[model samples]
Target: MEIYALFGTSGTGKSSSALELAYRMNIDAIIDDGILIYEGRKIAGTSAKYEKTKIQAVKRAIFHYEEHASEVKRILDQIQPSRILILGTSKRMIERIVEALQLSSPAEYIPIESIKPKQEIEAAQYVRQTMGKHVIPIPRVEVEKDFLQRLIASAQQIFSSKKEMIGETTVVHPPFTGGRIQIHPQVLRKIVLATCNDFAEVGQVLKTVFTFDDLPRLYVTLSLKLPYGRDIPTLMQDIQLALHKETSFCLNIAPASIDIQIAGLELITTE
Candidate 1:
C-alpha cells in the first residue's frame, strides 16, 4: 500500500485538518492518534488522546505499545487500502509509526503550513496553550464512550462548494495534556448536585452521572417535589437550561448533553 504523511508541530491544526486532506487526496483510510479511521469512522485501535499523561499519550500515538501496534497492523492487513494517510508532529514520528505498524515508508509528505493559514494555526495554538483544547477528527458522540466527559468538546466545520456540500468535520478534546488544570470527577459531581438542589423544582438529586467525553455532559436523574399546578415540561426545560448555564458559569466549561430523568414528582400539600 502507498502511504502519505502529514507533518506539523503539536496543536498546529494537523488533526483538525486531517479529514479534509484525506478527502482531497482520495485516501481510503487514516492512521491518526493510534486509531485507524476509515470512511470517517474509527474502526480499530484506541486513541492516544484518551491517555491521562502526555508521555503515555505520545507512546500510544506512535504505536509504542505492542498490543496497540499489533491491533492496528491487524486491521491494516484486513482492509489493505490502496492509499493511506498518516498524521504526526514530525517526520521522525511518522517514520516511527510506519515502522511500528510495519508499513512502507511514506511516498509523499505534506506540511501543515501548506494547508492552514497563519492566523488559523495561531488560533489553534492559543486554545491549546490557554484553554488546553485539543481537536480530534471524530464526532463527539463516539469520543464520549472512551474519554472523560468533562474535558470533551465538540467542533464542526462545514465544507461546501457550488456543486455539493462536503459535510461537517467533527472535533473532540481529549484529556491528555500536561499543563492543563485537572478537575476531579467528585468536584464536578458536587457542582451538579449543588446546582440541582438550588433549583426550586428539584427535590433531591437521585444520581448524577458525569460523562467526561464530548463536552463534559451530565446524565442526571432527579426527584422533583413540584408545587401543585406547575407545568412539568416547562419545569424540566427550565432545569435543563439552568444546569447548563450554571455549569458553564461555575466551572468555565459547557456541557454538551444534560439528560434529566424525573424519578419522582410530588405535589405540594396546602394546609
Candidate 2:
C-alpha cells in the first residue's frame, strides 16, 4: 500500500488538516489517533483522545494496545486501500504507528508547517493550550455508532466539509490533556517591548498598546536611529517579523495585526 504521512507537534492542527490533505491527494483512507476512518466513516480502532491520562493517551496514539492494532490492521487488510494518509504528532510517532500496524514505510512525509500557515498553526495551538480544544476530523453519524456515545451533537463545534466532502470536523478536548490555561495580559505586553528593544535600528519605543477584544492587535510607536540612506520599509518589516515570532513563542498566540508607526528618525552619517 502507498502511504503518506502528515506530522506536526501536538496541538499544531494536524488533525484539522488531515481530511483536506487526504481529499486533495485522493487518498482512499485515513489513519489518525489510532482510528481507521474510511469513506467519511470510522471503521475500527479506538481513539487516543478518550484515554484518561497522558501516558495512556500516548500509548493509544502509537497503537500500543495489541487489540487496537489488530482491529485496525484487520479492516485495512479487508478494504485494501490503494493510498492512505497517516497523521501523527511527529515522524517518530508515525514510524511507531507504522511499525505496530506492520505497514510499509511511508513514501512521503508532509509536515503541518507546509500544510498550515504560521498564523493558523499558532492560533490552533493557542486554542489547544489555553482552552483545551482539539479538532477531530470525523463526520457526524448516528450517536449509537460513536465510540464516545456520551458526547452529544450540541456539545461539538462541527464544520461542513468541502465540495469533495472528505468528512465533517468537530472541536473537542481530549480527556488526557483537558483544562484551561490562563496567561496574563502584562506578560504579552512585556514580550512586545523586549522584542522591539532588541533591534539596533530602533532608538526608542515611544508607545506600545495591545488590544485583546477578539484576536490580539498590537500598536507600536518608535523613534529610529538609522544611517542616512537606510531603507525604512525593510527595517520596519524586520521588527514586525520579530514581534510575531517572539509573541507566538512566549504565549502561543500571535497578534492578528501589528501596526508600527515611526515617530522620529535620527539619521547618522554613512561615513
Candidate 3:
C-alpha cells in the first residue's frame, strides 16, 4: 500500500486535509501521529499517550496490543502491499512517520491551513466537492461474524463458573435476600444492545462503523450516513466521545456485566 503522511498542529485541520487528499488520491489508510487512523477507527500501537503518568492505562493498552500483535499482523498481511495510505500527525512526529514510511527523500509536508477550506463554514462544500461515495472513509467489514458470538460465549462460561449468591450468602456485609442471584443472560443481551445502539448512532454521525474484532485495538468503521439539516462536525465530535467510551468496555464476568463486542455495523442505506 502507498503510505502518505500528514503533519500539523492539534487544531490545524490535519484530519480534514488528509480526508480530502484521501478522497482525491484514493488513500486506503491514515496514520495520525503515532496512531493509525482509518475510516472510523484509530489505533495506537506502542505509542505514548497524553498523560504519561497513567501507567496502568498505558500498560493495559500495550498488553492488549502485544498479545494481539500477531493476529493484527496476520490480518494486515492479507492487504495488498501497494495500497495507498495517508496519515495525519502532529508536526513533531514527522520524523517517526518518515522512518515508518521509509521515505528515501524528504517527505511531502503539506501545511494543513493551506489545504483547509477558508473557514469551518466551507466544510460541507469541501467534503462534497472532494470525496465520492466509492472513496468514502469506511472500514472493510472483516470483523468476522463469529468473533462477538465467541466473546459472548466465553463471557457466559466465565460467569456460569462463578459462585452464585444463594441462601443468604454473606461476606463482611449484609446477607443477600434473593434465592437465585445468578447473572442473567438477558443482562448480557441488554448490554450488547445498548452498545450497538450507540454504535449505530455514532456510525451515522461519523460516517463510519466498526466490527467488534477490531475493537480495543482500532476504533474502525465508516460513516454511511450524513446528516441533512444538523451540524456535521458537532455530530462527529459526539460520536468520537461515544467511541472512546465504547472502546474501553471491559466485561466483569463475576457480576456478568459482559462488555458488548462491537462487531461490524449494519449500514443504513437507501437502497
Candidate 4:
C-alpha cells in the first residue's frame, strides 16, 4: 500500500485537492490530515472545532487523531490491497505524527502556510475598485418568501414591496466586494513548495518510466521571495539526503547544479 498525503495550511485547498487527486488516482481511501476520509463517506471523530485555546485545541486534535488512526489502519489492512494515505499538516506536526505512528516507510509530507487574509482582501478590493463598477446580486431564497407570507397572514410583521433609491448603486456581490488578489502568506508558501513537489514528481516519473541506471539529466527551477533563512537551504539538503537514504534502486538521486537564489527576506524567525 502507498500513502500520498495532501498537505497544506488552513484554507490551502487541501480537502478539495485531496478529493480531486484521490478520484483521479483512484486511490482506495484518503487519510486526510490524519483523518480517514473515504470516498463519499463520513467517519467518526472527524468534527470541525474552533477552539479558543491553542494548547487545548492541540490536545483535542491529538485525541481525535488517536481515535481514528487504528480504525484507518485496520481498514487499510483488509480492503483496497493498495492504499494511499494523504495527510495535511505542517512539517513539525508531521514529524511528531510519524514518530508516534512508528511508520518505517517514507510517507509523503507536505508543508502548508499562509501570509494573511487582510492583505489578500485589500489587494483584491484594490483591483476591483480600480477595474470598473460592478455588483453581484444574491437571489432571495424561497424560504424567506414563504416566511414573509406566513408572517403577513399572522400579522407578526408587516410586509410591503417598497423600493426607494437612497443613493447610487453598483454591480457586484457584497461578499465578493474585495475584488480578488493572491497575497496570502500560506499561498506564497504553497507556491514555493509546489516547485519542490514538482521536482520530486519529475524524479518519480523518470525513475519509474526510465528505470535505468544512466538516466538523462533533469533540472528543476524554483523561485521565492522570502527573508534569507538558513532553513531554506537546510530543508533542501534534508530532502536530498532523505531521498538518497531511502531509495535503493537503479535511478541515482543527486542534486542538480543550478541557481537557488533567494529574492528577499521578509522576516527571520529562529527555532
When 1 and 2 are scored with lDDT, the better candidate is 2
Query: For model 3, how does the per-residue alpha-carbon lDDT over 205-230 read when each residue is reduced to its tens digit?
Result: 22232222311122333343433454
Predicted structure with the largest TM-score when compared to the true one = 2
What digit string (tens of lDDT, one per residue) describes model 4 on residues 1-271? 6655555444333443344355555665654433444543433233122233445445433434565556655655556536564454465554454444444343555433232233333333333443321211111121133223222111012112454211111132222223343334444334334445544222221111111122222232333333444466765555444433333121222222222333333443445
Clashing residue pairs found in predicted model 2? none
Pitting candidate 2 against candidate 4, the one with the higher lDDT is 2
Per candidate, the number of residue pairs that clash is 9, 0, 20, 21
Model 1 Cα lDDT, one tens digit per residue, 186-224: 887788887777777788888888765333567989888
The segments of candidate 1 whose C-alpha lies over 4 angstroms from its true place after superposition are 157-170, 178-271
Candidate lDDT values, in order: 0.79, 0.80, 0.36, 0.37
Cα RMSD for candidates in order: 12.7, 5.2, 21.9, 22.1
Candidate 4 runs further than 4 Å off: 48-54, 60-68, 101-104, 107-271
Output the lDDT of residue 46, model 1.
88
Off by over 4 Å in 3: 33-75, 81-83, 86-92, 98-107, 121-271
Task: Report residue 9 deviation for candidate 1 (angstroms).
Answer: 0.6
The number of the candidate with the highest lDDT is: 2
